[model samples]
Target: MPEQSKRLIQLLENEGPMSIKRASAKLQVSERSIRNYMRQANAKSTQILTDHSKIWVQERKPASLDFSRALPQNYRERSSYIIKKKIIEKEEVDLFDLSETLYVSYSTLKNDIAKMNQEFHAFQVHFRLKKDKLVIFGEERQIRKLISHVLAQETATHIIDMETLLNNYDKNLVHIIQQEIEQIVVHPALSKNDLAKMNLILHLVIISTRCQENGGCANDALALVFRTEKEKQWFGQLIDHLQTRLAITYAKEDLEQIQVLLAGNLNFRASEPSFEMDQKNIRFTSQILDLLEKRFHVDLNREEVKELFLRHLHNLNIRAQTGGFIKNPMKESIRQISPTIYEMAIVMAVEYKKYFQVLLPEDEIAFFAIHISSWIDQSNALNQKLKTLLVCPAYLNFQSDLLQTLSTRFADELYIPHVASSEQSGMDDGYDLVVSTIPLSTVSSQKVISLSPIWTPYTQQALSEKILKIKERKKGEMIRNHFFEYFQEPFFSVVRKTSKEALLHQMCARFNEKEIVASDFEKSVLEREKACSTAFGGFAIPHPLVSSARETKVSVALCPEGVLWNNDQKVYAVFLLAINEVDKRVFLNVYEPLVSLLSDEEFMTRLSAQTDFHAFSSLLIHKIK
Candidate 1:
């Protein structure tokens, strides 16, 4: 059985029988999947759990997955591993033999090799499959670094076990290499994460072994910005030492790439000691914020948002340099749950294009989105209040006393903006709820809650309850009004294809045809996708980095049959955004439906099938409300 079966049984026993919705969300699986796992678990064990159609399993002592359990090998991971090993071995690897050993079909292995070739493309390396064997076609250094990433994955922790590594290659050669790197790489110092450190060591071993095979990495494949001439000379001296010791000539490009791997990945303290953040990092972070201000009407200059973004940006710079992407396992759930924040984050990330050459991955963007999510919620809570008007025409003391009482009782919930006479037409103003000594108008009778002029506690309690109910109604209206405003029939459609790129292209074209967006809006959306995919669940919420549209609206398209969204997911619904300055405030309200839409497959299927605009609009608005 799949491992999910065992996990399901274990979860049920530990947490009690869970509803499918709760279990699926916790397990990161679909409701149908959780149910299927339940059935599978029941077949193998006497333990059972039930709750209508939505359920998990129960206790089975001594329970474990079958002992002979073998993890289904991931084709991509294994293929990369095999290719890297073969390339480092400096001999053509027989495809037919390797495929059999890996318990995979030869044809599948070939496809993996083809994909690997693409990774090698940027690094001055390529692979050739000839004579029924795969051959590495690149310099020694590039070859080794590529292969080392594969070996590093074999261990549980990112730190390399030198003992295990030498067992596979040459022990003495690696030892010499270790001794040399320790001697040269010193001074102001560079830093390394566990993974980067392993990568560094592995590349050294590769260089040492390849020297024995009369090989070296190409030099100067790409130019890199180094800190100073002294540092450049120091790096050059180290490379020269390696060449002399190994009796191999290193390519300028190979040396350049290695320098980047070392200097680029390692963390170095700022030269100045005064400020907490390095001046450069501080400047870069500030620039990013400034760019965001230019793009969105939403104010992100709040101290809390600034501090959090700075912390994330500092890490992101390091990650970009080292190609270090700390996996955000919560990425899917975060996007699915808080899409408005995620959407804003996506657009904010576009501003990075102006300052930095490297782009942060979508995972990083999602993490940033999470930071913004907290702020938005806080702002909402702080700002949600019932606008109120007070009437006390008879005496000034009465108005003052009543105002003071309401403020004391409902400080956070009520905004008492007006205190007026019975003739002030206060009720005609746009106050949400009215507190009056006497009724002002026939229209305001229902909203005007009469309160005691003596400011009694009993009267205060009743008014507070009434205000709470009004606030709920206002909140509901906030969502309903904005949603209905944007999601008109003209904006909705059932797209024929689900490919994210194609779908986005078609949606943007529609927006342009309507003259809703600038010509570059679609390009911006695609650029965002290139940095990190926007695909979440069966939906892709693509938008420009900055809202430069004629009007703010979501261009809706649905592909009932899923299309490949990114490396890992597929999306069926595509909501291409062209948000305006005004719409930014209601973004969360607009996208709240996404959280529900992704969870219910049956609903999304019905949505995708609803080609009629009126029916689609009604069904969607109904489901959401």
Candidate 2:
């Protein structure tokens, strides 16, 4: 007997006197359908349903036509027949052999057999299995029609021209394409093309999964799609090219998504070239760089400034391709690097560029920079310390009152010191890096750092570190006489006395017989710049591209009379740096610390104060600690 009809008979017998409404709900079907099923049951067996809406059953009857239409099309009838045939013939068949002959997955065959047992109670068909085969004991004719009806009603969708599609690509190639597609789908920032690719890869992966489950041939045409030697070689080349250009690593998931897209018949269109730069964009970048140098004293050159703008554009292109509508993380990183008004203006440019093909408005960029400038000023104010005197002069009472007012208004990390007279030192013992109200002579020799009385607390904090840094930098600049022995020339020299161009040339001559090897010079300069800015505080350490010396050495030129660089701050000191292999070991370790010391104003002042190179070197080593 068919499992469905037999199960229906059993349900009616167990739940006696139940209405079709209750039965339909329990069976997950419409009440009308349940009633029709019950009517069909009544016609098939008089004992199956009682008169006047009550049902009674003797033994369960085999399933009827009413139960057949609801069964799944795949294997439903075949499973029922196999069980029934086995019982009738009293013969066993291997389940594995049956699965192979049926051209169905082992799991599907197993599920079908399991479902027969689960739903058999309703159909009144008893199921049993021996070592190799299943048995179904029930009336045959009724069950046969029921199973046939269900199989006919169940819907099935056909696979799209699998053979032809598989034939187009080798099985290995298909596998590769499937893998790439799967990766694209799982990525966070997916473009429309990425999504399409994902779907394609999924289609291929599903087919591979399906084929594997059915124990098919390992080397199918689909697998050859991504796996062919020529295809793999091309894929490797493409990956290398993209990585080199984009500075991005493709994840395994990305590869999977690509494979899926290709397998599912998708394509990725290349982006069109863009060349035009809007005037607003160019002006906006120029203005920001101008403000950075003018307002914050950051000495960024024209090319360096241009590179910053280019980085933002690159970020925008990447985000656009990824279907991202938000500002890129690069903007935030730049803000963290230097929170100047100019940086904020660049951020605005990045945001507005997405909306218009042309450049953004100049006023908008200026407005952002202005607002940022105001915010930075206010912040700096909050970080400043106020100068206070405790001396009782003729206007002591008035001065005290004024000091109180100043303390309330602008004092942060404020200092109040006692003074005997106008000439007396008013240094606070408990303050951090004290400044006195009296003249420099009146101050005690207690290593008290000096700040310009005109300078704000923000400037004090910034300059205090700057000056101290300069003194420490002197240690690294100390001349090593050993270099002269190896190179048969002074370890360092000053060329044009004023021009950075002259300094670079002299440094190059020390390394190469020619003053400059254009290619090597450019490459070295770029590498040095990338490592860190050569500009330490107001001093620029411009040197040769190569370290041709035998020993690590530095030639220092003290321009106590500062030279003009294109920017605002005068260049005070230039260190001609030459490092042999041994010197590099020490220099690399100490370079950052030395750079940091240049930020201390006191150290820079002390270093600048020294007349002799030995005195400068002594002060430098002392300050480095």
Candidate 3:
């Protein structure tokens, strides 16, 4: 059945008895297409029932179509289906016949193949058509890599898994492989997370399927030096089980490739190595810690933390080498909740790129951020407590009870050093935050929280959120203080919006005229921009890759019409930074917090909308408070 027809049937089954017009509108299809969908759906099965105006579904019958095995619906899916069959399965396909199966015309199918070939060019894989037969052209390693990429994306959401590939592999065989993977015992250090486990399972499944179909032809040149005897034993046992169940003898090259795969992805060596560390990773981890220490003014070179970061970097390097991409579902949350740590991870990624010439993915960066966040949490545990003032404004007994409740609830996070009556609230400005039972006119709303005399789960949740905001605001205030020192009135100006490069050149020239930066500062800034964009969170901070300035200064350019920083980002605020050698650390202190604070879309918009420097500075300082 056509994908549209199947979708229409499913929609009717879900929503139940929707008018034809409404169904057409919901699906974003024309009424005529809706009618055609009903006709096509009923042609296969009498599940869809339609009248003049409305469409509904009858009782679902024994399934005539196995929707579980998804038909190639869109271009991506269609390309994947073709690649899997013709390349991975090594099956010759007639274009006309395959096009009919996919419900796309032969010409459209040809166009898809062309586009797919273009997309796969970087992977060194291609599809070629001669006469009517479609064939794949690529080395075994490239072909396997492409296959891994496709399958990984297909199963990224886990909606499509081993069972979905039943069209190529036997149902019984898929089940056996899944069961074998489930039964396999891995080392304690190996990841058992859902995403990591799925990657291993899918890798094994693909190996088995390719070996079963093409036998020894699935061999590759990839190799790995097993760091432990346990990894070798595990690989041997896994291969033995698969060979016995699937009735195939693996080749020597295939065995070696599997060893590399296991060591890089499935073995404990990938994530948490108990054995001797790789010297390169040890150096990289040390350098990263040193950078963090120098940039953020904190030492994290303790042996325990060093070993942990070393293992993580070693595993990350292995993933880069082996084309192993582990999905991190918490990447966005991690970025938001601990953006300073995320920025630190980006620095690590930049250093890694310098060493290996490979840029890590966002997920990997996020994983590194988690490690750094934990380290920061451990190192700062003693000093991270929030200094708070409690204002109960009740009887002595009730005030003591309130303090006890707060201490019991937030002992680790909050340090209630002072207690003030409602009348004394205006007199104290020393506390980081004020937790009061009554609203106060003196305290900034950002620094004050009003709660009921009685506490509940709702109160706890609200207070926790307020505390997080206070911490974020405190960070912003620190950055703002360092920032305003370098932000001069003479350096601030309003400019007509222009191209990113043009605006950057203009600003660099202005800085050069002021003799604040080196002669080649513009070149260095453009080089840095080329390496990695500085435009983020609705603002751009362009600076030299290596700082060499006569004086540390930040030139502010307000673009009311917006400057096009890249294809995706347009910015109204540009902070061109020129940092002297002595001020490099100071620049970094301002950079991370500024990025985090500007990540708030509302705040960025409000700050960028200011036409004058005074207005922008005032609004920023106000927001910080």
Candidate 4:
């Protein structure tokens, strides 16, 4: 049930049938509207009345004639009764004190009690004033049923009416629809008309879901399907647009089938699969082709699907061996885009009869691998090693050539190369470090190192010294088991020799059982394996984003056992990063150097050999320099 309807029902169940004025105040609606709704409800219940005489004879009618007349006059009195019930059922409340809170004159409250007693007697219910409190003694089941009926009446008359559904809740539904439309909108194969028609069909589906009844004919459904003349124009425009967008002709029968499926009273479960198939066979293929040609600027034909599939499959196989699976990542990306993307993909797959043939499992794996690889590569280029400028004599083009040589050697390690002319020297440009071809006349205050313009062994040795000095100054002090110390108390103790799942569970228990660590972190770490493999040379850095956890902390685990991570490598160190916030600049700066060091085979061999925590810390601190 809808939340509004459920809440209304709960309110009526607890408070009983109430006056139009009282009910409106409780529900925050106008009294006139509540009265009109009650009249309609009474009209509907007329046939259910057992005694004809009682229905027609005013004197014979029940004193509590309808729900609108049954509520208590003052809000305080009603509130007291509600609180009293909860405490009585659950075991405590002081009702005598509650009466004092209502602030009603004692005599006025007595008169109100007398009125309730006279009215409830007609329904075989008694209102007893016990110890200065009101309690209803009556048929429990019958009272509950009446309350449920009253709530249902209010929902049908107020909440689910045309104006409320269209103006209030429809915005959220329309947003979802718009997202779906964009997915198929720019397809190269689809004309403007095809996209418009698909949008119309979706709009109609939204209207149908909000309809009151499900057994209506297409004509009746269409009447409720659209509310404005603009909607009618959109519907007509959609049909015209589809005709021009699709190369394959859709017969009159196909148009009728669409109308009937959308407007007829079939349940969504029964209609959705068939609707998807029709879209795939006719709409999606044309749309995809249009998008590729127009938006992506790629010309694609039917024959290219096979080649694309093969290439994707090969990449996927290599990734699967390294990364665990691609299904979850693809699903996540698609879900993030919009709900419509998922719906559209499903429809296209079903209609084209390529639902099972496309090897989506592999395609998805390749997509995530490409995404993560590009992200890592860009991050490394932007922030890895410091940028340096080589200032040489203007006469010797050797300085410029040396810059190219360095760029080619460190292409994977640094950003694009920058060369500075002799005139530009001593300018204090934003370069992180400066390597001078000759000693400058001005005393160099900046990080300056002199170097020869040759790739000879002597020059290489001199360059390494300068590079080491820069690295030592840039990389700061290590954390020194600070993270471990943060969780040293009884509430956060060590979880030794535990499985990954067990450790995760223990962490959750220590913090709060309600805080759940995202399972996707494991999937993301595993999925990262497929593309080139996380085993970069020898070390692997496995981390997940802040959204994947409720808390953020880098859990560094050392394995002297040297567990095999991939076919070509073994992991001696693992950094389980639990990022949960955006202010992780420090963490981001450290990530590149850590990944780079891990990539070195010699570093991993030494890291695995180290036994003590001090030795491990010393090795890391030494490497930073």
Clash pairs detected, candidate 3: none
For candidate 2, write residues 1-625 as lDDT tens digits. Answer: 3344565666654433344555666678786776666666666765455332233453322112112323324754566445533532223545776666556666777666665544333234556556756655666543442332222221110111223234433455454544443443332212323323333433343334333344443222222235223334545554454333333444443344333333222211111112245566567666655644343332332431242243334434454565543322122222322222333354445445533433333333433443333333322322223333333232534343333332332233333433333444444443333333334564444423443334466645654564354334333443232223222334333233466555555555554542212336534754675576576667777645575343344556566766554456566666656554324543554556656666687777667656765576667666655
Off by over 4 Å in 1: 1-386, 391-402, 405-415, 420-429, 436-485, 488-490, 529-538, 563-571, 582-606, 621-625
State TM-scores per candidate: 0.31, 0.22, 0.31, 0.28
Candidate models: Cα lDDT each: 0.58, 0.43, 0.65, 0.41
Candidate 3 residues lying further than 4 Å off, grouped into runs, are 1-385, 389-429, 434-456, 472-484, 512-524, 544-552, 560-562, 579-625
Q: Tell me the tens digit of each residue's lDDT in model 1 across 160-238.
A: 3465456545676667666666677653222223433444565555445544564555445545455445456656777
Clashing pairs in 1: 191-267, 218-251, 218-254, 219-251, 219-252, 219-253, 219-254, 220-252, 220-253, 221-253
Error of 1 at 492 (Å): 2.7
For model 4, what is the C-alpha lDDT against the true structure?
0.41
Best by lDDT: 3
* TM-score for candidate 3, residues paired by index: 0.31
lDDT of 4 by residue, 241-354 (tens): 543332123333234344433221110111122222333323444554453233212222232122222333343444446653333322333232222123223333322224
Residue 167's lDDT in candidate 3: 38
Distance from true location, Cα of 482 in model 2, Å: 11
CA shift of 137, model 1, Å: 70
Give each model's clash number: 10, 70, 0, 16
